[model samples]
Target chain A: MSDLPENLKYAKTHEWAKLESDNVVRVGITEFAQAELGDLVFIELPKVGRVVKADEQCAVVESVKTASDLFSPVSGEIVSVNEELSDAPEQVNDDAYDAWLFCVKADNPAELDTLLDASAYGQLIAE
Target chain B: MASYSTVSLPTVTTIHKTALYELHIELGAKMVPFADYQMPLQYSKGIIHEHLHCRNQASLFDISHMGQCSLKGSSAAIGLEKLTPAIISRLGSGRQQYTVLTNSDGGIIDDIVVTRLGQELTIVVNAACKEKDFKHLRKQLSNDCQLQELSEHALLALQGPSSSHVLQQVAPEACRLQFMQACRTEIDDIPCMISRSGYTGEDGFEISLPNRFAEKMARILLNFPEVEPAGLGARDTLRLEAGLSLYGHELDEKTTPIEAGLSWLIKNTHQSYPGAGTLLNQMQNGTEIQRVGLLVEAKMPVRENAPVFDNEDKLVGRVTSGSFSPSLGRPIALALIDTEAAVIGATLFTRVRNNLIKLTVCDLPFVPHRYHRS
Candidate 1:
């Protein structure tokens, strides 16, 4: 079984989101995504105030093998980002869920209900 | 004498395998199709581990899939000179030169390693370009020149700081050879040609032997505690960090050796080859774009074909090859930029996906070459 934190929510694209408040949340990629990408050589994140649509490619994660897009799980305006990744992107490989890529002020907090729970995300990755 | 089988990617049914294919499978290598052959990309430890290990100690690589050919006879030297403008005629026996095969337009067809051994000239060409390279050699050379493709032989590279010490254990003569020099010798009774040259920046040897002894030789070398078998994944990163150009990525049919910053490869030959006219023109007027190494500022690696922009946001060039350097602990890249923007320390920007990233022109070989000079 893969590590899927039961307290958080996941997207099919492999991003994990944790609700910080009723209208705000923090987002990062899951361990599975980082492992699949291999040694994180580069990470491109959205700017703090950018509005991203759900499922839009708002960032990129590059590995030695290839580059993968980071899709937003919900519509939101970015509030903060992990600046540490600018120098050490491999932190995502160290602990993906803890190294939150960005924080967002959600436009619709209700959309969180549509995301996969830890159990559903676990089953999805298994496939 | 050909044994290479380049398989079509659509199906996995008929991929060619090297002599060490079974050994790689037993070691848990993840095999993938490369230049028509099923080669290992990585093993159980993955690419990063293999890459870092090669730098720290010594790593053994199976490069037998590369094409090997021999040109002999009294006219061999002149015949090969007609194909490339390198100093082959004056190239003394036992000397090896890194040269290029050019078309009539001065564009690079393929980058090759030519070594003068006894009366025959041994050539190592890229795996993907081997078939065409051999065909071109046969067609272009005069009848006096005999071209024999040595496809039945296997090539192995043992690279790193400890390579000399480990290899010297089996054959003491190997340690006496200098960088870019080759010598024919027997390693544990396996007849081989060992060259103290490699794609990796580290000091190493590339040994070629007949097919029957290849697997036996690899097993003997791997028996050493300091030598670990590395896959193609580590091979790519090591070469990129060393600033060596891949034939297809950093060279192509439309690009010249001049643009690739390989002017040194062209010797002053009075005789004209295929691209001599165009090469002379470029030498006089300078090239439109030049290849330069980049030190990517952030963690983002600028992958192949990513457009590069100057500080003014004008598109100046594109990255030919880019990757994070395990040795330098920073992202390093090779880009083909306008000649004006290729100055060292010049700043540039490139897009990795949708985000803009910063890069600066710097010296090649993110890691200094530690070749054994003596």
Candidate 2:
């Protein structure tokens, strides 16, 4: 909750979704998740044109000691991925929200409404 | 809106804590359950930072979980020779040799380091196999040899280039000892059995002292600017880069020393150890599979149990140990593969999830060993 942006919504799987427009949303892991994963060394992002369902596995983040699957916060089509991460995965460790994993075009705009706000997400992590 | 199954947390289990447990906690270490003991995985500085520091300077490791015991008798070395293929009789006093305990079928029971102190032989064994190793020793050795577990003692490893200098301030005589030598000395008035050897393939010393003085000694060593506390995570990476074989991975009950790339440990003339028949046979002929180093082509780590395949998709071997080397700045591994695939520079493949990653056979010791021989 220390750096959880007030405007963005969060998924229980530790992913954050920021609606850029009516249909497009930027997705990334939370700062809390990155801190738990230690220093990341590699990341495998989903294909740009791949169709994904809400809460489905879409990417992977690997730290020096372990690797974790990143689940999609909402159902959509992946329009773009962060190419910069392939060269410097540590960028995500530097700033989790800033290093967006991918941009998805949401199939249903109402799905964002179901995500947790900053206060709710803060409580979940605190527990 | 969608519910995803959360990663299940490991159940709370009571585990043994070392004498340095409180010190490790105070140092902001991330504790993990390992070998039935609560051991430090890393400190606040992280694994990569600690690993690099060990290579450039020096680091201290709490290895109290490892088992230490002594075989007391004039014939202790000869008695131990019956269990291992190493020529222990020739080992002079105040010297140590890395050897393995073999079963009747030539399979490795456990790898151990045996030190000769006058007429007694002291040994250090793996933490996971300590109890079993001692039981085996008790049953196998003759009545003349008495086995005593040094359970009250705690062990510490101070490794890297500056290790000798750091240790010299407290125990001066330990610095003069050559590699693989041991001596009973006092450090800051605390009695200890100091040895010039370590698992990191670096110039270091393994200090064994009573548990009561462990925290005091650790604090003293930590006061030195050249020494920092390292955890089991960095230890694994350092040993991996050093190309040292880890038990339960590169070695197991079904694997022999010859197949594990430890043929040098088997003395050519001595063939009377537990599994001498099959060991000498493999030594004269060859093993079916050999442990070899691999240079992983992909950025992703190829971890243990990953299947290795040849060009035709035929399964040839499996990865024993794999990780992203902090020093090489790339992924490296060790695989026990068929003799045909053990060729240096030969390309092999390992499946990671949905992709087949390419791997090349490379020479061991991704990093060179820096021992203080002089």
Candidate 3:
């Protein structure tokens, strides 16, 4: 099983989010998801300052095999994007969590309740 | 059988496993349904490592799913030439050549490698097209010739710079063979008809033996530290970097040899094959669409069937195959474009999502081939 830190929250789509501040959240795909995606070649992130709804397709991640739409985990405005991924997209495969796609400022803080804890997400992929 | 391409092929409930299926599981391979067969997409070493390993050292690939068969008879060589555009009758025994089977309308039936070994000819076709390819050959051939499919055989390719060095540890005769040569040989007393050819554009040999000894041969080859197991993922990237076309991606029934950039295949001075009427006509007057290579400066990879356009946004062609070239550290693709725009160094556009990226028309063999010739 891939490492899933207990403090982080995960979406059923294999994205994990960590709350960096009171309302600010860091979002990226889970380690298990990156391994399944093989070597990531390119990434298209949502623009900074763009407002995105939870579960909305806001970005795209392309591997040699296929391209996948990256879904936003929370309804929020994007504050930052990983610009280096345009040339070094393999960072996600090297370290998924550290290579967050875009940071989001959550609209309603309690929306984190809708996400799964590390244990729950672990069980989801195990099935 | 189906394709390894996830971008293509429909979802299915059942899949056939190869003889080395258990061994792949033991190596911690990620299995996926390819050509309706459960196949290893990547091993524990990952696609990049396996790909580089094959280029620098040696890699063993279980390609048993490809269709292997024989055409036998006094007229096997002469009669077989009538169905395809290759000069099979003149191909000579002990040699193989890359050729295509064409339909009556001048479209390709399948791209295959035919090896003429004395009285018989051995053919290896794509697994996805084997069923229909066999049915078509049987229906078109005369009674004097016999078409036999090797249902109980397994194929493996040991490839790279050190392939012959590692293979010499088992079969010394492999070292004497040149590229595109085939001979009846043995490893550990198990009979195998090994060919000095491969799809990865490497100096390699494809070994075919009975199904019962499949794992035995794989184990023998893997005993060498230089020979590691590579999977279909690495196979795809390697072939793509080599600029070799995959069956379903770079070709299909609707595409012709001339349009697919395979005019060299029809240059044997004999066009007396099926589809000769239209194939010859197209050969005389150039094909409207020409298959060419593309180098993308952008980070995003242009995918198959993506609409290609001129700088003015006028539709000109479509991408046939695309990928991030591990060997070159950039994105490259094979596209079919209007003959007018197929000139080398011409600029083209491919739409990815909502973005139109610039592409330069380039010559093929993204990486140079290293085949060992006589």
Best by lDDT: 2
Q: Write the per-residue lDDT of candidate 2 for residues B57-174, one digit (tens) a residue.
A: 9999999999999999877888899899988888898999999999989999999999988888899999999989999999999998999999898999999999999988999899
Q: In candidate 2, how many Å is residue B368 off?
A: 1.0
Ranking by TM-score: 3, 2, 1
Off by over 4 Å in 3: B1-14
Residue pairs with clashing backbones, model 1: B6-B36, B7-B36
lDDT of 2 at B21: 96
Clashing pairs in 2: none
Query: How does chain A of candidate 3 score by TM-score against the true chain A?
Result: 0.96
Cα deviation of A42 in candidate 3 (Å)?
1.2
lDDT of 1 by residue, B1-374 (tens): 23485754454445699998999999988798999899988887778888888888899999999999989899998888888978688888777889999999988889999998888799999999998999999999989899999979999999989999998899989889899888899998999999999998999999999999999999999999999999998899999999899998989998998899887777655447888888877877999999999998876677889899999999999999988788787778998999999999988999865668999899887788888885
Model 1, residue B4: distance off in Å is 29
- Which wins on lDDT, candidate 2 or candidate 3? 2
Instruction: Please give, for residues B146-176, the per-residue lDDT of candidate 3 as tens digits.
Output: 9999979999999999999988888999788
Candidates' C-alpha lDDT:
0.88, 0.91, 0.88
- Candidate 2 residue lDDT tens string, A12-103: 88999999876999999999898778778889999999999998998999887787999888798999999999888889888998999999
| DockQ, model 1, C-alpha based | 0.50
